[model samples]
Target: MTLRPISEDDIQALVDERLDTARRSEVEAYLAANPDARTRVDRLRTLGRDLRTAFAPIATEPVPAQLNLAHIVEARRRPRLQVSAWQAAAAAILLALGGLGGWGLHGTLAPAGVDALAQEASANFAVYAPDRTRPVELAASDSAELARWFSARLDRKVGVPDLRSADCRLMGGRLVATPHGPAGLLMYDDHRGTRFVVLMRPMAEPGDAPMREHRFGSATGYAWAQDGLGYSLVGAADPAVLHPLANTIRRTTATNT
Candidate 1:
């Protein structure tokens, strides 16, 4: 008998790395045959990485004094809070499953939250990249002014990396908002009108990992945290085309810092 065809849930499980080895292999085979499904799975994985980057620090933070065991117990005695072990276990399971048991929970879980940078970046690119009339708030000719604007808003020095060698020139930038605060997006485009965005904002905590990479649907991204700032570069270009630009930006930024 034929195995049940892969469902969206299976793709999500694969993206979440929740599938067992055998199941994962099956999903991989399905993805290999279906490029569109593979892209969606990649996007989900990228969103998960961004969420973890934003929220992982909370897991390591010290409990507040008001939330200590003694204080909690005294509060419970005064105004009894009831939660069964089963309820707690179920809550834990939900968190483990990324706050839902199914893919239907995707759009419901995020709406400009701090953990949604990748999702927003991907969405923003999908929205603005193709627009010919008005893609950026500022124009490239005022490169200095644009950098100054972003630097002032971000409260950190930010710059547009020159990628002329890569045939992509600065197309200006815009200030975007995340749950934490305002973020910066420096846009660029090649002669062919292929667009890319470099998004940057402050990190929620210190000591995050130095660097990582992700793919959001048809786009590729490189995410890194350095000197209390987090940066992500997203584009629809293949990884080979994107990697050099990302590296050049990282090196240029490091030198300036």
Candidate 2:
């Protein structure tokens, strides 16, 4: 019997475990013959699994009392008889607080240099990590092309880090914009399905900087600068475990540059 051609979406579905049972065997057979696609699917599965594990706690948390619908409606109707100046002020304050809460998510306020790099990596991880279908535009088998892509976009000689020694396989990468400029975001995963990201962008000025660990809500990342480039490796893992992995990236990047 003739079989249907496998598309990128099919591979994504296989990795996400969302492929139809009838097509599951067919896709497995195809991946068995295609090493690159097989590898990409494995890493993507890891990324999705890790994303769920990391965000499950936050997903289960109850909504804050201040954000409760009943509370807001009650407050609005509390002064039906006559809205006093203090009541009006309180309403305005609640609105102001809501706006302030979102400022960080929108990157309206961020730290300078390395911290910003880490924060951006963490933020990007939150976005792409959860996306099982299209976490990245390019796959790890295209590392050479990925390297050239990042190099041209950043206007620097950027190279893809080889994390095989660290047991973190490169899944893929895509270009992400930062307040500073365009940044390259690479995703990776380990055997245990632990996923992480590495973000690199050219610094405004060239100077060596010490490695710093940053925690962005539930995400943890390590950021540093060497030569003229800034790099951040972020994941949902703890700082101690990620420390060595970040070092591995540092050495790989240094050698590649």
Candidate 3:
């Protein structure tokens, strides 16, 4: 019996596992006629396997003690007192003095470069976090399209990290203006209903390490570079969750290169 030709949608659905049992069978039958389709599937499967092997080790690590749930709950319940203008000015003065003192200490103090980057990242997150409409230029449901679109906008190749294993789903992306011109924002959500991570990178700057972590406010973020592109992971998830995701991103991205 002659098999029906496989449609692009069929191949895509198979890639995404959205095909039903009968449709899956049909796709397999079609592949028997077209070995090229099988080759593509095999390549994708191998890529996924490599990513899993390289990064899954991080998932086994113990959660950090600093991520105590009780502390987070207590912190949420604490009163958020508003400071008066005079009080704000006084606090600013104190901060300036502290900064100057730290600067005087020089080598004794860690450089504020990372801290500045964290503040910048936090500020960027704050601006978009409350945005309910058009938070992302591309939706997570269209991650492949997003990857292509962002790659063009940033003038570098970009890829979305698969988070299903980590129990998260993509939440779309937005383009935001930054000190370095335009940037991309890709958000994700885990089972907790909490928005987990925001991956951001300069639309222009290129060349950096595979990963860097920054602590901003009460949150920690991981950023990285791979294949001549930059990436940043910002979220409230525990380091245990975020770190593995970062490793996966690094591995997947490196493989693609």
**Most TM-score-accurate candidate:** 2
lDDT per residue for candidate 2 within 1-257, as digits (tens), equals 99999889898888878888989999999999999988988899889999999989997899899989998998888776366767787666545433322226452434678976777787788888878899989999899999999999999899999999888899999998776778999999889878899999988779878899988777788999999799999899988889999999999888889
Clash counts for all predictions: 0, 0, 4
What is the Cα-based lDDT of residue 106 in candidate 1?
54
- Local distance difference test, each candidate: 0.74, 0.85, 0.65
Please give the lDDT score at residue 67 for candidate 3.
Answer: 82
How many angstroms is residue 25 displaced in model 2 relative to the true structure, after the best TM-score fit?
99
Model 1 quality (TM-score): 0.55
Predicted candidate 3 versus true structure: per-residue lDDT over 64-98, tens digit per residue: 86788998787766643333655787666555434
Candidate 1 per-residue lDDT, tens place, 1-257, comes to 57668888898888777899888888899999999988888888889999999999998999899879998788777644345665687666446434321222353644332234555566557666777888899988988888899899989887767778778898988887654578887889889888998877877765444555677768887777667767777899988888888888778777765
lDDT value, candidate 1, whole model: 0.74
Candidate 2 CA-lDDT value: 0.85
Q: Between the candidate structures 1 and 3, which one is better when assessed by TM-score?
A: 1
- The stretch of ten residues in a row with the least summed lDDT in candidate 3 is 101-110
What TM-score does each of the candidates earn? 0.55, 0.59, 0.49
